[model samples]
Target: MDESDGEALAAREWRLIREERWPGPMNMALDEIAAETAAAGGPRTLRVYRWEPSTLSLGYRQDPDTVDWGYCAAEGITVTRRQTGGGGIYHDSHGDISYTIAAPADELPGDLVESYRRLCTPILDAFDRLDVPAAFAETGRPALHDPACYLRELHPAHDVVVPGDDGPRKVSGNAQHRRTDAVVQHGSLTYAVRPERHLAAFADPSVDAATFRERVTGIEDHADVTRTAAVSTVEEALAEWADAAEGSWTEDELARARERANEKYGSDAWTRRRPGDR
Candidate 1:
């Protein structure tokens, strides 16, 4: 190997892949690739991406028929399923930024719920930076009965909420997928968009947007700042958190990610893979 190769190997490195803003499927596909890469031996990565033209993304387990296709299409929204399980989310450009964290499972807790709290702390710190009074929804029943991720009350390490006279308002929605090798946890940081759009996408006919908003709060709604400022706040907070944490993936690892992305994530079979596909 060349002398420079040794230097590159010795230096701690992390790959940052920021492709042009893509649609929902592309973003999810790339994140799956990154996770597989980590699983194989690639350095842990943080992929920040946006859905262009906006779209409504459903959790992997959710049935497509559950979404209001006509309503989404009329609003120029594209629909796709995420690798993670959760309710439908109407992603609007300029309203939110999404993050996917790919890392080895060894670095996180064994229990899925515990892992969520640990990962979400930085998000709480970001809210603290904004001076927003936020806390994780307490763990238990209320958390489970709420079908929509954003609608659920804070759990030990779930979403963030701003306490109010009436109750808590959700400001973020996050979820995780734990693989044998790595974990990919992602969530949306709400910005300028209306929760009504997401509420409308739900198949449930009885839900009311006003009532939901009255209970839920986006980052923009909870903070005493501008939307742009909140976005920057989260960016910086996550960066700091990652920096203090030490770890790096090897080149061979990235190659594995490519293989996984192409074979699993990139394939229609995997993208459309359902509950019993295994």
Candidate 2:
């Protein structure tokens, strides 16, 4: 083969992992595995997953105490923390889709914000293909110490949003955690609004639920887009953008995720971190 053809063949192709809905701990464990695996020269990946029984995920440095424990206990909501930084998100198995892209850091841009923007090309393309008219947030002003991820003013550069008459309602929220030689970027692509109280009850017991729902948008809100369609759209986008080949996980990656679950994700010592508590 010619040198150029050889280079083309050597280009990294994505391994697709369409994981079934799992617990918050295992979900996060898999993400960590994505990062480490990519750093170790594993194949690039596009992973899709969901949360079962509904779960609430907090930012890396966020205070777990910000959540109203009584509310969660009464409602049976699973509380966990993400490896990436951001506000807390309520992962509804029946309501949303979660996706992540893992590749060598060198494959991505060096700038933090730009890297975030670029990694989303496939998602943006997917939305465009679906005629959803979604784009990145134009302004990413920080939230006023709010624990609710949806409550934060959409970080224009960091999030994907759908424009509407009411405002720019965020459709997806993304964050990044860089490994030595790899990068893992994950986000939630919701299709419908959660029960306002599901998020409000824990984020702030006093906030009205209906108002919170207005701050965000779901794929279903426009064009009645189904999760299945959204997933397919994204998969199409990935294939078009990267020429990625579909594949599955290696035994080593699964083992790493399992080990991470035992030591980090599954442990309250890691998830339940608060200001003074640990």
Candidate 3:
């Protein structure tokens, strides 16, 4: 190996992956690839991606039967599952910025809560740069995990929100999946929220449209933010805060992701698989 090759290999490097085209299955597969690889002594990766035709992404352990398949089918909305645990989310193509940040477990705090907050700084900083008045929620989480991530108000320390007369309105929904080798945290930032649209697919009679509106507020609704602007702001600030060097996926990474998609994420056995199903 060349002398420069040794230097490159020795230095701890951060990688940024921006996904321009990926269906629900491929996206989830890629996130898992990053997590598993990092845990196995690969480079850390931060990913920003978008979904096409929108998608309803279920939490890892969430019962797939919770959603109305007939409604989703008729509406042409696809359903997928995440490697992380949180409430399901509607990734609207028009109004959401999705991101995943993963690193080896040793690089982050052992305390899960502390690590979650640390990863959120980039997003919170992006909000500040956009001049969006933001703060972490000061309230506590629900006693039980809400099926829909947007429905369950996130922990005040981890969720970024804007002030409201009623309370802090959540702008971002985050969740974590801790692996033996890596800690992956990913989330959605809504530029616009059509709660009625999302609720129609995921919420049952237990949740009403009014309640959904009250709990979640879109960035656009709260400010003049657009999807492009939000994404750009995040790309710049998040990369800087995390000290990442923009990069692309390696061939091996893509191959592993595609293999994972075929074996798990795209399969019925996995998408609908409940926790401990194995």
Candidate 4:
């Protein structure tokens, strides 16, 4: 077969894991496992998932002080740190739709921006499918609040925004963690805005719900789609883009992910550590 035919066949063999709901640590652990599996010659995987009981995912280097521990505990929000760097995100069970794409590093472009564009194409397509008119932010905007992901400064590569009467408002945030042999890009697509809960996740976030409403947006804000429809749209978009077949986790993979969650993602030592300490 020709090189083009070979590439097309490879794309069609990609794996799609339908949305599953899990706690924060397990969700993060599964992402790591997916990357490792892909690097070991497993199928390239695209997984959609939700966090049950909600969660607050802190950036790799985000300050612990920025989080409102008391508030999170009171509200039953699980706090965990992600391998990717960015600000903290409040992953509301009803408000956020999250996804992860994992593949061998060599399969993606070496250039960071190019790789982001390649991986984020399906996300943009998903927004289009929902009639949300979302696209990568054209320029970086000065942060309205530093510790919150949605309120942080926007980057043209991974931050997706939708047009508003006032200006563009952010709708999604994507970030990557590249290992020697694999890459995992995960993003949160806001399905519905929960500005109060988002801001409350941070300690003394100098901004209010009104300011958040002005700067951030969700799929439901611009489109008439319901949360279920939004989730399905994103899944269909990713599957079609990768030409993927539905798949599920193997028993061994799930076991390893559980162990990793307990030892790393679920541990306070890992979550509270400084940036380079790990």
Candidate closest to the true structure, highest lDDT: 4
Of the two candidates 1 and 2, the one with more favorable TM-score, higher being better, is 2
| lDDT of each residue in 1-278, candidate 2, tens digit only | 23553345247766777646778888898888877777777777788887886788889888877887777768777777887877788888777788888888887778998887677877887778878888988766445337777777777667888877777777888888888688899988877778564565464545565666666777777766677877777776766566667777778778878888889887889888875454
Better of 2 and 3 by lDDT: 3
C-alpha-based local distance difference test score of model 1: 0.66
Off by over 4 Å in 2: 1-10, 140-145, 200-205, 276-278
RMSD of each: 6.7, 3.6, 5.0, 2.3
lDDT of 4: 0.91
Task: Tell me which of candidates 1 and 2 scores higher on lDDT.
Answer: 2
Reference-based lDDT, each prediction: 0.66, 0.76, 0.78, 0.91
Question: Which prediction has the highest TM-score against the true structure?
Answer: 4
Residues 1-278, model 4: lDDT tens digits: 23563466356358999999999999999999999999999888999999997999999998888989999999999999999999999999999999999998987889999989888988998998888889999977789988898988889988999866677899999999999999999999999889999999899999989999999888888888888888899999988787789999999999999999999999999887876776
Against the hidden reference, what TM-scores do the models get? 0.78, 0.89, 0.89, 0.96
Q: After superposition, how far is residue 86 of candidate 4 from its true place, in Å?
A: 0.8
The regions of model 4 sitting more than 4 angstroms off are 1-12
Give the runs in model 1 whose Cα sits over 4 Å from its true position.
1-20, 139-147, 152-154, 244-278
Pairs that collide in candidate 1 are 37-257, 41-253, 42-249, 42-253, 43-249, 117-157, 137-154, 137-155, 170-217
Clashing pairs in 3: 39-181, 137-156
- Best-first order by TM-score: 4, 2, 3, 1
